[model samples]
Target chain A: MKKWVPTVIFLAVAVVLIVLAIVFLPVSKSVWVWIAALLTLAIFSILYRDNPIYRIAEHIFVGLSLGYGLAMIWHLALWQIALRPLFVEGRFILIIPIAIGLLYFTRLIPKVSWLVRIPISIALGLGSGIAIPLIFQATIFEQTKASLVLPEMFAPGNPWPGIWAIILIIGIVTTLAYFFFSRKEKSVLSPVSKVGIIFIMLGFGATFGLTVMSRVSLLIGRVQFLLREWLGIIAQ
Target chain B: MKRRIPLTLTLVLGIVMMIQFFIPHQFSQDFKNTALEWLRVIGGFAFIIGLASFITHHYTKIKHKKEGWAYSPIALGALVVMAVVGLIGRSPNMNWIPVTVQGQQISVFTYLFSNFFTHMMIPLGATMFSVLAFYIASAAYRSFRAKSLVSILLLVAAFVIMLAIIFYNVLPLGDLGEWLLSVPNMAAKRGILLGASLGGIATSLKIILGIERGYLGGTK
Candidate 1:
């Protein structure tokens, strides 16, 4: 009774949901929309606590999500991939991908784990190759460009601002030096790195403050829902 | 046989996917998309495993009459009803009358989700996350002490930034705040990014070369 009861109940429900999702969901806009919403709510119940209901619903959710994903892939990729390109066009390039893709499944075998690296190497090399140049452009050159200054200032500019700029330049250079992990710093870079540490803490403090506000916003959203929707009474 | 075939396929597929990104050909893009789709399917199956475990865990809990097992019925009921409603609603040929009139299937599900799920779940999560605020405040008060030159620099910069936010009168200090963010912060952020990039590249290389067999769960 323990095992079979839940299985029977779950299977029955699963069948109904599958039928609803495949057929009726496309017909009635308002009804199926709410069904979708309810399904979301049902799964979310786990946040409060776990129970058979939540477990069953969560399982169904997993099943449905998986089933949908597979269906979409079959619809969109299978014909275009294995059949249209490789089988139809007879392109030799197609074999390369087929071979590489096959490498990912090798983990299932006890001895062929080493063969998996062939594909892993290519992916890593390409990802890094793209990232290196992009990083140099986005970080080093752009920052240097922003820090550029003219000897002459606009007519109404104060020298005080320029003095601050010199301080800022000092801070930037020293702070970057702090992160130079490879070499030991015994020169002026040591004190400069110390100055950089100060800047890092201040920056982190401000970010922590901002995160607090976002969290508050999320809480208010829940409180508002409970009071206004469930109880049907809330202060404006 | 299962192990050998799947492993062989993985090797060939992984290589193809890696090269696809750089191939600049239509076939390559199609192959990449297919690989992503397959990964999504696998991920979906993982979720089903989770659900099965959940049922097993709860069923045992209820049967053993564990503490707080009474709530199991409510949870089980909710799961069953949801599944039924979902199934019924999924059927196009079931006739909308039973759904609309008898059970009010759609509205019942909608009410259950909105009144219960969003109202309860989202807020609870948001509240748990918000606890970090009070924690931060206390931490700052206790730990942000200045005993040396570096600490003092940090203290002053933080004070200036905080003052800029709360009081409108500190107009001049706003420039100090801006300087702290754009100049020093930018430099540190860039350095961190560079280091992270290097780490990611290294990890990716390890995974590709089969040096990082950890992902495949200890060599099988």
Candidate 2:
């Protein structure tokens, strides 16, 4: 019932586990394995109830993640992609982006925070503009093209592909129609949309199922790590 | 003066990038690359804003002795330690503060950085995500009741997919499962994709044309 009880229990268990691992496992991997196991257990503690150990693990994860991202962006995006080209490669034209990027520092000054929008607008505009044709190409053209039935699909005794193709196209159209918000109950889209809703449900179900399996796989991986590597209970 | 410059700049860059996509000449290709590089540079700077915001939040929390303020110090400390190690050590070629580990000459920063990432970060991150399995199961038990035909369809699809994948050797629904996904699932996904793409393209055009000014920060 006490607040400190969880922390004490976690520490006591961690100490025992580390000592046990060090005594049994290879010395080189023992320390890291035990530490990882401890962290894993700490995260797992949240499943039962919110505890100090879980909080510590959660905070540390957030901190380390942000730090990793920060360093990565600097090294990859800034140094390699942007700065090196400008300073070392004598690409002075990069000064345009450099100047724009410098504007981001204006956020620190309350009066000139609006200046930060310059860089933002540049990024947003370029990204949006680039996305327009690319989205159409990737999502619309390619997907529609793929949905079309080919002669080779029904070639030779494999006529099942033709039926499946018709079914797929029907599913796609009906699904799209279901999303047609402006259709009246008396309209042609009404019946089509009704069929669309069924496909949507099936899609949702499949997606949910797939998501659960993925998460379970992740859980299985961590469990295997604990059992095989740290505990040495399972064969390598 | 304030809004016009950004709006005009956005319009020019947007038009340029869009036009460059159509023109596949060496000059146009080079222009696109240059624009992307510029975007990357500016994007890198954008991260600092997030870093600053995070630090400010924790700093304020600690300063005011807010609820659970005790954890803020740990969060901030871990962030600083990881950032310092990562910045110095992660870069393979930078080789700051060189040290030998297991016959490899590497920086102490790199050694510590990698250990933290591998041991601390990976376990913590993976476990955090993995634990969601329990919550999802709990949610399914609590709210995923099959009271309607739609709900039953959803349950059947999810159950079939899970059963087929997890117990592929035991279940004979492999072909059916695959069909369900490739046919019905693909149909719905493609439908959603088409709609979303249209909306996204429209929004993008709106932003480029200065019609969507919300990102400019004010209603004005």
Best by DockQ: 2
Q: How would you encode candidate 1's per-residue C-alpha lDDT over A1-236 as one tens digit per residue? A: 66547546654786687566656433333443344334434544444444455554554443333333333343344434543576779865556655664565564475776555544444443444444445456755776666555565322657755565565566556656777666575875787777777666656654544455465555566555444443334653
The clash count of every prediction, one per candidate, is 40, 0
* Candidate number achieving the greatest TM-score relative to the actual structure: 2
Q: Rate the local accuracy (lDDT) of all candidates.
A: 0.53, 0.87
Clash count (model 1, backbone only): 40
What ranges in model 1 sit over 4 Å off? A1-192, A216-235, B1-15, B53-111, B114-117, B148-179
- In the order shown, the candidates' DockQ scores are 0.11, 0.83
> What TM-score, computed on C-alpha atoms, does each candidate reach?
0.55, 0.95
Q: Give the runs in model 2 whose Cα sits over 4 Å from its true position.
A: A6-29
Q: Residue A111, candidate 1: how far off, in angstroms?
A: 15
How many angstroms is residue A52 displaced in model 2 relative to the true structure, after the best TM-score fit? 1.1
